[model samples]
Target: MPKTTAQLRQLWRAYECNEAEMAAIGFGPDRIRVARPAARAFTALAETMTRYRYFIRPADTDSYNCRTITGGTLKSLHAYGIALDVNWSTNPYVDHPGTRGPRFSPKPTQAERALDVKAGRADTDMTEAMIAEIESLCTATGLQLFKWGGHFGTLKDSMHFELDIGPDDLAGGLASR
Candidate 1:
């Protein structure tokens, strides 16, 4: 069944997130309201999350305010209300210590996750199979997907997807009351 905004919000709450974060992910504060199609897509993603143990992570402060994209150099889909991070394990790409004590090689560090840009690692980390599942469910509900994990070569955030159009298009249809 197609998902409504209320359904999407409920799904997010199932993951133990608060309303504020949900609002950010839904782009509710932006000029554009979340479209029904996109809401359907988000609901599918939430259902998909059950498989991964309700595994969506909140955006870190940096990611929340992140302004750069494309290898840490350009603006990211997050800034556009088109993307989100799943499970923190994959997003930051932390480099921890090795078997050796302090003698280990330097862990991967970025100016501020700056490494996320140079390589498509961010989108790539999300895995195509997972993204496909979300896409499949979304498509079944007639929702178009815009996933960074699919189109980009970097990290793959299977949980992340949105409508290709902007908020302007969302005004009509289910959102226009």
Candidate 2:
């Protein structure tokens, strides 16, 4: 069925949409971007988020991991085709020492900030609520939602989500669990 703005807003609220991440790596100047896989998964999880509301955009291919920021870390969910970042104004995955802004702080400059604000409609920061929504969707679909925020403490890549299960069972599980 078609979704109303209210319905999309409601689902977004439940998933904590207000706390969207500022545009950073993978995300171009436009913050309203999402990967094909993430968008498909998101739609499968909750069509309401996509119904009538076209605020999600497509993210870039490179700069998808947190290793750039932490240096020593495990492979990113993007590497396994289960994760994606949103509204990336800068590369949060990169390690920036002595930086004044927060680890995942929203863009500070006017140009960077403007780019992020403009793209926010289509993209989203992987907040706890967002993660919960993805997890819920994965649970309903029988797909495992593996997150970078789950393992790391210092850096929680909010825009990342993927299936932890092996390849042979990636899609089938979506119907089982």
Using TM-score as the measure, the top candidate is 1
After superposition, candidate 1 runs with Cα above 4 Å error: 1-40, 51-54, 59-66, 70-74, 91-129, 139-143, 148-151, 154-162, 168-177
lDDT of 1 by residue, 1-177 (tens): 334333333433322222233332332112222322345444445556556433343443122223455456644444433345544344433333332111111224322223443343342233334455655542333444444333323333333444444343333432210
Model 1 Cα RMSD, 1 decimal: 13.3
What do the candidate models score in CA lDDT, each in turn? 0.38, 0.36
Locate the minimum summed-lDDT window of 10 residues in model 1: 98-107
Model 2 TM-score, 2 decimals = 0.41
Q: If scored against the real structure, what TM-score would every candidate get? A: 0.42, 0.41
lDDT of 1 at 112: 24
**Candidate 2 worst ten-residue window by lDDT:** 14-23
